[model samples]
Target: MILTVTLNTALDITYRVPRLRPHASHRVTEVTERPGGKGLNVARVLAALGHEATVTGFVGGGTGRALRDRLAAVDGVSDALVPVSGPTRRTVAVVDESTGDTTQLNEPGPHVSPAEWAAFQEAYAGLLGSASAVALCGSLPPGVPVGAYATLVRAARAASVPVLLDTSGEPLRRGVAARPDLVKPNAGELAELTGSHEPLQAVRDTRRRGAHAVVASLGARGLYALTPDGEWRAPAPDRLAGNPTGAGDSAVAGLLSGLLDGEDWPRRLARAVALSAATVVAPAAGEFDAGTYEKLLARVSVDRVTS
Candidate 1:
């Protein structure tokens, strides 16, 4: 089983518009909603790949209930979310049909009380006992300590479970100190964390900061991984065009799935790159076309980096 922690879960709403113009009003052609946040996205992708995933984090009020209801309907995912007094937040993604661009409006999640935080910690610890691997993902919600991921990483390590962390800013900085087995940061997040825009330099700096290994997501270029065994650059066969919102989370699912199967780094990178590309072409976030994934998996190229 895989354990995924989302500190700030959300009801993700996507709106399709004919065109987005500044200071203009238009009818929304379509609306779709789903349980979201990076970890939830990862869990959804993992479940799609036939892995049992447990999602834990804070949720409350009407929106939270709605999110949980959807989770209950989804197969292969268990909801272990802790309740808070404040209502869960929502994120709106306005997608332009003409240009395939997205305009995003996000709400800060519910304020978590100290009591809720404690309850979450206890629940997470119990889940870790049965988890084959764990992923700590996304932003820290209000009233939650910045070191939350660090603490959770430590607990996973204590249980002898390999953990993957995907976050940004101070939370990521602190979490790295716990020496997680792996850290996945997109290029921008890597730059913000290490002050280097260059992918190779940034990943190395992040590793020096404490992560045992670092996998840098370079958007459509694919993934650059620096691990104990060596380094490798995995590139997509072709630049895919579509919604890339959940591509990173899909990659996270790939890495965890590969880890569980005891696959080598090259295979892991291939799976991740293929999954990410598949998500790019999928109709929605946290989803992929099985046929595309199968085709891309064999096409993804993994080349070792020697310096």
Candidate 2:
């Protein structure tokens, strides 16, 4: 089983409109809601790929309850979320149907008390015992320590479980130093962490900082991966227009699943790129179009990068 940790869980709400204009109101044609946050999104994708995933995070209040209700309906996923006093947050994504653009508004999640944080740590440690691999993902809620991911990474390492971390800012910096088995950061996050906009250089710098391997997402260009075996560039066959909200999470799911299956770096990167592209064309957030995924999996090209 794979364990995913999302400290700041959310209710993801999506609105579809004909078009979006600055300072203008538009009619909403559709709305969808789901349990969200980086780890939760990853868990959903992993479940869709026929893997058993266990999600642990902090959830509370009405919005939290609603999110949990939706999560319970998802097959192959187990809920192990801890409760906090403050209400969980919500993220709004407004999609422009005409232009295929998305505007996102995110809320700062609930404040987590020290007691709640402690309880979560205990639960996480126990979960590691049964997990083949673990993913520590997303932003830190108020009152949680900035070094939260770093702490979790150490726990996973000590338990002999391979860990993947996907986050940004200081949490990511500190987590990377904890020497996670893998780290996946998008372009902007990579620049922020390494102070270099160059993907290859940034990934090298990140590995030097302590991550055993680094997979940098290059948006439409696909993925750039630097692992122990070698370096490779996996590019998408074509750009598909749709909501790209959960693309990175899907990529994370791909990488984790590939690792468990003992796939080589080339095959793993190809799978990650294909899953990311599939998520872009999906109708909803945190989901990938299965048909698109199957087609792209065969089309994604992985080229080894040579010095």
Candidate 3:
């Protein structure tokens, strides 16, 4: 089983409109709500792909209850959400149909007290014991230490479970010091961490910062993996477009799914690239088109980088 941690869970609301006009209201043709936060998104994708995934983190109040109930509806996904006193957060994504671009508005997330943090640590320790691998995703909420993910990485190491971290800013900086087995960061986050927008160079520097391997999500340029085996780049399929929200999370799900199956390293890169492309083609945010994923998986090209 793969255990995923999300410190700030949310109920994500996605809206689709023909175009986004500043200071003007438009009729939204669609609105979809789901249990979200990065880890939940990963669990959803893994479940869709027939992987057993357990999600655990801080969930609060009425929103938390709704989030858990909704997640339970997705087959093959399980949750061990730690209940907190506050309300779960809400994230909004506005999709422009004409250009297939998405503008996101996110809430900062709820406050987690020290007691709640302790409760989470207890739950996590138990989850780590049985999990084949662990993924620490998304941002930290209030009252949680900035280095919280770093601590989680340490615990996963002690249990001998490979840890995959997908986060940003200080949490990422701290977590890297623990030398996680894998770290996936999008280009913007990668730039923030290493001050290099050049994808390969950034990934190489990120590897030097203690990620055993660095997989940089280059958006439409597809996926790049820098590991002991070598560096591989897979570009996303062209001539297809849609909302790009959650593509990175879906890619993480794909790569981790491959890892759980004991797939060869190159195959893992292919899986990540394929899923990410499928996610871009999906009209809805955070969900991938299953058909597209299957097709992209077959055509994704993986080539080694000499340097």
Candidate 4:
């Protein structure tokens, strides 16, 4: 089973409008809500890929309850979230139907007390015992330590579980030093961490910082990976038009699943790129269209990068 940790879980709400106009109200065409956060999104994708996934994070209040309710309905994923006093947050994504653009509004999650933080750590440790691989993902909530992911990475390593980290800013900086098995960062995050906009150089600098392997998402160009085994660039077959939200999480899922299956780096990159592209074309946030994924999987080209 795969374990996913999301410290700042959220209820993802999406709104569709004919077109977004400045200072003008538009009629809403559709609305959808789901449980979200980088880790939870990864869990959902992992479940869809025939993996048993368990999600543990902080959740509270009506919004948290609603998120859990939706999570319970997902078939292959199990909920192991810890309860918190502060209410969970909500993220709003407004999609412009005409242009296929998305505007996102995010809320800072509830403040977590020290007691709640302790409880979550204990819960996470317990979950790791049964997890084949673990993913520590997303932003830190109010009052959680900045070194939270670093701490979690240490625990996973001590437990002999392969861990993947997907986050940004200071948390990611610290987490990378913890020497996670894998780290996936998008273009901007990579540049921020390594202070270099060059993908190859940035990934190399990132690995030197302590991550055993680094996979940098290059948006439509697909993924660039630097690992002890080798380096490779996997590019998407074509850019599909849809919401690009959750594409990175899907890529994380792909990489984790491939790791457990013991596939080579090239195959793992192909899977990650295909899943990311599929998520872009999906109608809802954090979901991948199965047909699109299968169709693109064989087409994703993985070219070895010679240093």
In the order shown, what is each candidate's alpha-carbon RMSD? 1.2, 1.5, 1.8, 1.3
lDDT of each: 0.92, 0.93, 0.89, 0.93
Shift in Å, residue 194, candidate 1: 1.0
Scored against the true structure, residue 45 in model 1 reaches a CA lDDT of 84
Q: Which is better, 3 or 4, measured by TM-score?
A: 4
The per-prediction tally of clashing pairs is 0, 0, 0, 0
The digit string of per-residue lDDT tens for model 3 on 160-201 reads 999999999999999998999999999999999999988788
Model 2: weakest 10-residue lDDT segment is 235-244
lDDT of 4 at 270: 89
Write model 1 residue lDDT over 1-307, tens digit each, in one string: 9999999999999999999998999899999999999999999889989999999999999999989998899899999898889999999999899998899999999988888899999999999989999999999889999999999999999999999999999999999988999999999999999999888999999999999989989986789999999999997657587878888999999999999989999999999999988998988766887899999898888999999
TM-score of 2: 0.96
Cα TM-score per model: 0.97, 0.96, 0.94, 0.96
lDDT of 4 by residue, 1-307 (tens): 9999999999999899999998998888899999999999999999999999999989999999999999999999999999999999999889898987889999999999999999999999999999999999999999999999999999999999999999999999999999999999988999999999998888899999999999999987888899999989898667588878899999999999999999999989989999999998998767899999998887888999896
Q: Where does candidate 2 stray beyond 4 Å?
A: 18-29
Candidate scoring better on lDDT of 1 and 3: 1
- Candidate 1 stretches greater than 4 Å from native: none
